[model samples]
Target chain A: MKAFTTHFKNSSMTTTADFTNTSSITLKLEQVSKQFGNLTVLENLNLVIEPGTFVAIVGKSGCGKSTLLRLISGLDQPDQGTVFYDGKIHRKLNGHARVMFQEARLLPWLNVVDNVQLGLGKTGKGKALEALNHVGLESRAKDWPSVLSGGQRQRVALARALVHEPRLLLLDEPMGALDALTRIEMQQLVERIWLETGFTAILVTHDISEAVMLADRVILLDGGKIDLDVKVDLPRPRQRDNPNLIKLQEDILRRVLTIPA
Target chain B: MSINWSKLTGRITGWVLPIFLMMIWEIASENGWLFSKILPSPREIVQAAIDLSISGELAKNIVASSERAGWGLLIGGSIGFFLGLVNGLSRTADRFLDTTVQMIRNVPHLALIPLVIIWFGIGEEGKVFLVTLGVFFPIYANTYHGIKTADPQLLEMGRVYGLNHWQLFSQIIFPGALPSILVGLRYSLGLMWLTLIVAETIATTSGIGQMAMNAREFMQTDVVVLAILIYALLGKLADMGVHFLEVRLLQWHSGFRQ
Candidate 1:
């Protein structure tokens, strides 16, 4: 209910971790900051992603990119500031929002498909299988998560996040644990799934190119603030070989690398 | 499944020492190196088993002991499980009763046989009470520990799901505590047998333990040995029953694999 002044810095370092314009918004955060005891992780953050948009948050290790996602996902509350979804205060994740963690975090006791359907109140077994099928893991439905490959496990996690038909999807470095080849494959799978689902996605990643390739707009966060908000303007299904994407990636990388060591 | 005897050799290896000891006992008895009054021959024990079977005494005693154990498990285990859940979930209840229960746990239930006899008068109530006391603490302690030790991360997941209190407990806390609860049940079943034996020996007029005590007075070593064997067999069967139930109930668990 309080008016929050937005600070737009000339350089990448001074803006809050999330920076968005009032001109177009679906999800918005204003003057958000979070602190744990003495350490400040997010400071006066502001951002917006339009309906069915994919936004990538890129930051160095301690810049609170994941923390920002956690706040958005309602996994954690911001100590200060308000997050709005569809003009309503984003409070907690209901069936409307779901998060996929980097570790997959599948229930080990559950089979792959059951793990996908976990905590889906009143959902049918058939629909659960359909979600697994959508993730191309129908054959491994009855298999334990422990037996699945890392890529397969992540696929199961993706299915789980999708099963509830959430309007918003939060990815917290979901591919960080996968090998290089697996990570690329999973990135492609995720991109295709996001396009198919038409769900608003906010991805937090350390990989600059991952942000550029996957996000419609990429925000580079440094020092608990958004350093730069680069619009991809690149076409849907953008390829890694696209010159503009490559240039954008180079630019984001240069901005990120210029941060104080 | 077809054949893996080499892998099973360690399990089979344990039987060798027991068989060797039994053979030595038989040889010693046959050679009169041991007094027949003190140590019955294996054949004598077998003959006593046949005699008891003819009289239907062994069957009746086994049934009696088993019934006591069954009742003890049903009542004690259920109470312990529910109470454990309370102690695990409610800090106030835990604070009030935990120290009291710990203090009571230190008093050996078997040592209270005379008191139980005086209270219940060598009746079935005393025997049942003894069995219940024997089985209660282990199940309660383990269930409490299990609930306490449930993964906090999974609990965070439950919170993210917006599960209400009952939903959280039924879906998350209960399932998480199941492995430990099952372990407790197995241990309690064993204790049930132990307590039933002590109770029957002290107070009851029937059951396997009573039959053993009766045989001892008459110097019927064969009957005593038979009763002891029945007790061992019953303990093994009770354990197996609980184990089978655990496997069926928690087939999803990783522990079920081995």
Candidate 2:
């Protein structure tokens, strides 16, 4: 944990600003509103996430949190306004973005390595194994997805999403289907990757405690708008018992559950 | 090792009845309970098989029938598979072609025998044409069903991962539809033999059907029975071939896992 903190600090301190095609990525939404027929899912929502930031969006079931991730991932376009990736208008699926679903969405016919390689495109034979190694799944590279436990498949999916080193990684309740222990393990895995690569990460989740533990910024959405956007001022390697973390969780939970007050 | 006694007994029970029936027929023939010219005894059929096989008559008829069925299946199955893919993948293709194919499917292909005879008479073409028509529907229907029913979620995953059109088709859509397509292939093989037999019996001068008819005219009941046994063997062989293919190609399927 200390090593991770030290590494992130060092990378940020370097500040090698390159305007011509660099690694740092920024995602911005400008007055984006999406509606399905008569139903308004998101309305005039605007937010910006800086390079190498980990932000978590939490909301109730109908709060359009998933819809927000879809818009950012470029799977769907906002009906009202534009989303920008590094100042370019996000229209189709952005090449730099990748989204991970709650369900692993691993292709059943392809084995573990092939599924990872699917993300890598043509020049991916070696990088696929390397990606599997990143998620500690190099040993299960040859196994079919059907044989793996749910948690293992999710790990494989994380490998697939990361293999390409996507500039923007959008996660939609990736740990929702997992058991408590597996969810913690997956959270650690995700945090480790984010710390190491420092890609702009946005996680959409309903789990409030998860939002507190992993995210640098936790944005709570009420209906179609941002209700609370709080920055975590706690120390690195946050524990459940940490009073600061607990207090923050309580504060967010209160705002999330409040009914139009 | 202890034997699975119930399974072993069940297998034996299946073989016992057919063996017993053969024994009864042999006994009935020896006792003159069977008319010798009408239904030949098992011994006479086996003797006739040995004679025809050694004289190469059985081999020639068998080859001729198989060639016609094989060619017909090849041509019809290919066309059907291609059409199925087109109709399955493209809404435009389905709109233009699917209704016609579905309508034609309702007509029993065997009913076209008279018209087919006029179109391609007593030659090998008529028999092959009948087999092709008979085999076409099942293959087409199954391929269409297979491609149509390919899981949409998987296709979405393919798109999300940035697969190109050809890669998506080859890697996801084709394999997803393979099991259903194979089911169609298996069913079509059965239809192939059935149609060929009917066609050969109705029109042609060269196959096992002709051999059986010639034997009937001479009161060669033994040879006629021999042809029937050979037909049964050929059908079983075709089934075995298809079963082998299904196992080899679909080992990933849960049904074939164990």
Q: What lDDT would each prediction earn against the true structure? A: 0.82, 0.85
- DockQ winner among the candidates? 2
Give model 1's docking category: acceptable
TM-score of chain A of each: 0.88, 0.90
Best by lDDT: 2
Candidate 2's docking class is: acceptable
Per-residue lDDT tens digits of candidate 2, residues B174-249? 8888888888888898898888777877767788988988888899999888888888999999888888877877
Those runs of model 1 whose alpha carbons end farther than 4 Å from true positions after fitting are A1-25, A121-123, B1-17
Q: Lowest-scoring 10 consecutive residues by lDDT in candidate 2 chain A?
A: A12-21
lDDT of 2 by residue, A45-164 (tens): 999988877889998998999999989888888998999888988898755888889899887778899999994667897999999999999999998888999999999999998887
lDDT of 2 at A219: 87
Candidates' DockQ values?
0.39, 0.48
